[model samples]
Target: MTTGAEPDHGFAWPDVLCAPVRSLPEHSRLWVALSGGLDSVLLLHLAAFCHRSRVDVHAIHVNHQLQPNANETEAFCRTQCAALGIPLVVRRVSVNIGQAGGNLGGVEEAAREARYAVFEEILGPGDLLLLAHHADDQVETVLFRLIRGSGVAGLAGMPRARPLAAGQLVRPLLELERAELEHWAREAGIEWVEDPSNADQGYDRNYLRHTIIPGLKARWPGLARRVRHSAGACADSEFLNERLAERQWTECSKGSRALSVPALQALTVVEQKNLVRWWARKRGFRPPVVSDWSQVMHDLLEAAEDREPELREEGFRLRRFQGWIHLVPEQPEVPVSPVTLLPGEPLHWAYWTLTLESVANPESPSRPIRVSTRQGGERVRFRPEGSSKSLKNWFQEQAVPPWERACLPLVFAGSGDAGELIAIGDLWCSEQYSGGAPAAGWRLVVRRECD
Candidate 1:
């Protein structure tokens, strides 16, 4: 109860327990990812006992509300932190189960996603978030990935430290065994809440932790260390893979969002797969998981030139256009109806931002300047008296992708069918609305944001 006033109780912790906590990366504020479990509780006390005076120590508890004793765990964390004179931040998150990877597995993953989301949002510059993952957890993660037919990167398990949001996430006890932490925790008389879900074997990780890992450990005494060694080897292989991908990415890319199809085709299938995954990750999107890369790569690189082949992922897609593979972000929904453009007020249509500014003085548009998607049969006149060209023919002349043609914002100077196309989504603008001096005394400025 209340950890009996203070931790340690005059019991000296060995150097093995104090070393990891004492040595940490440079950080102005230290944060413990407290779950009110044995590992996190011990981590909290270790942080307080070792480096509380050197840095500002705090704790954050994410209550997923998945367990029956969620509130009890949160209270326990608060009590422990309060007793140690450390500030605690508690966040209650709602985990949606049926989104992706449905079922109990989904719940487990969703809860983890929710917890990390909170951690990422809370951490700021000069801050470090410490997690309590240990060697036993590492063993479980490796075995789980291996059983799931993961690649080298997945088999590598979690890193000891990685960047999170604006801060860093460090697992100081990753090299220590769980049993060692439990023994020290008991010796220090530290109190923690028991999560009921940990005992339930319905979850994959819980099943592995309770049923499989114990037997493996009993059969091989150094199972944790051995698995950790294998994970390190996989990590090394993953690093080399990333290096090769980086080199190939540089060769294939032409300093644009798109890559040359011929250059990609020159690479081996494995090389192509690695490069594409690296590119997706570099752009902050998850790589598409295809069961058969040979078919996908053939479609992407060797498909008929006229037929546009595309691979769609969660946040982005790769579409081949005119001998080049373009990485396009999922388009945002534009206005259903035409949006009127006002002077000095910027109109954000999907990825493009438009502003109609007066060259000499602030003034409104002479006619209703509206922004809308293509309605077909629209024509654009390059000159005031020149021959008008169909929008379809103009898009073809410019070699715009078919998928992007429908979503590009079409800005018109007037309303109804008679509206003259003033701008084509930052691609082209009528002479009257462009240049340093405009005939209409106002300039339509359009800018496109990187997708």
Candidate 2:
């Protein structure tokens, strides 16, 4: 709660405490993430006093099970929420602070993902996930992201409001300094539990909060205020760029997953990057190291269209073929072992849900079979008179971009000692396997969500 030089000229805090949230929907529910820290504690306590007719108020505490006093902290939050008369949902989550992105920088981010997963899970339509992030928090976030080399959107820092799973996540206290919240809390005699990890300077955020921000403020007073304003400007610029990129994407997309390379080359480099960033963010891809994604865009634009050059990160892959930049999830190296599908067991593959519906193909094999990806030169015939065509050639004829060809699940059926391709995801099946008869082949519904 660094206040700089300003004295707490706080009025009866609730009147101003809820001003930032006045714009919330009239028929929405507001759930506060009460972390038992001073900032979150004060935020939950203050938000309880708001008029609940417009938006109902509730509290949630995610027990990360990380600290020595985690149980005690949960107890403290329960007492506080009970006193405040708000129904509290205590969610216990296991945090695996494993390597995020391509390496080991996801310690803090993993915790955030765990916390927000609970937040999003509980939210219904038109709900608000209110956080307790104050102005000082925003300042630290901006500085931290800056030091780590954030692009324009990262430099913009956390938004006051954004889409959270099925609802909206809003931080109403971004305009109020932490000092004001703490001052009002103390004046009103609010009790909060202190987190032990705040003292650990090993974490980048704690380092910035304890060792950097205070001195930065002392050297350049009102740095927090100026930084917040700069972030706002960046946010505005980002919004405009998104709108422009949407228009560019509408014209330039080859399909849901690829972009037209010729259309991208026609744009300025800045526009191209903006379009790519806009697309990446929409598809839930993390920000790649600057030059890596940049290089992908470069190769997409300048490389020969016939050459299938590709770039891949942990979760995603990018490729250029036939004047389109194709992006898809990176398929892990899977051994060509066929999964045994029983009648009762539900089959869940990577990013797909599978179900076997009774279709009319009398020639359908009853035995369990292999589910695999494209092995080159494999072919399938759609009709009795038609000759088998390569899977690659079929993909091109079907207007399926090259990037998606490798990951499409192919189902193989076996007879005695020989196996033949029977199904290609939910898209098609061989004429021998196609369903329409009274009681023949089972429809293999490989349910997947695509953009």
**Whole-model Cα lDDT per candidate?**
0.88, 0.75
| C-alpha-based local distance difference test score of model 2 | 0.75
Q: List model 2 lDDT by residue over 267-298, tens digit each.
A: 88778878877877778886455565457677
Consecutive 10-residue window with the lowest summed lDDT within model 1: 1-10
* TM-score of decoy 1: 0.87
Q: Model 1, 166-206: lDDT tens per residue?
A: 99999999999988988888888888887888888888889
User: Which candidate wins on TM-score?
Assistant: 1
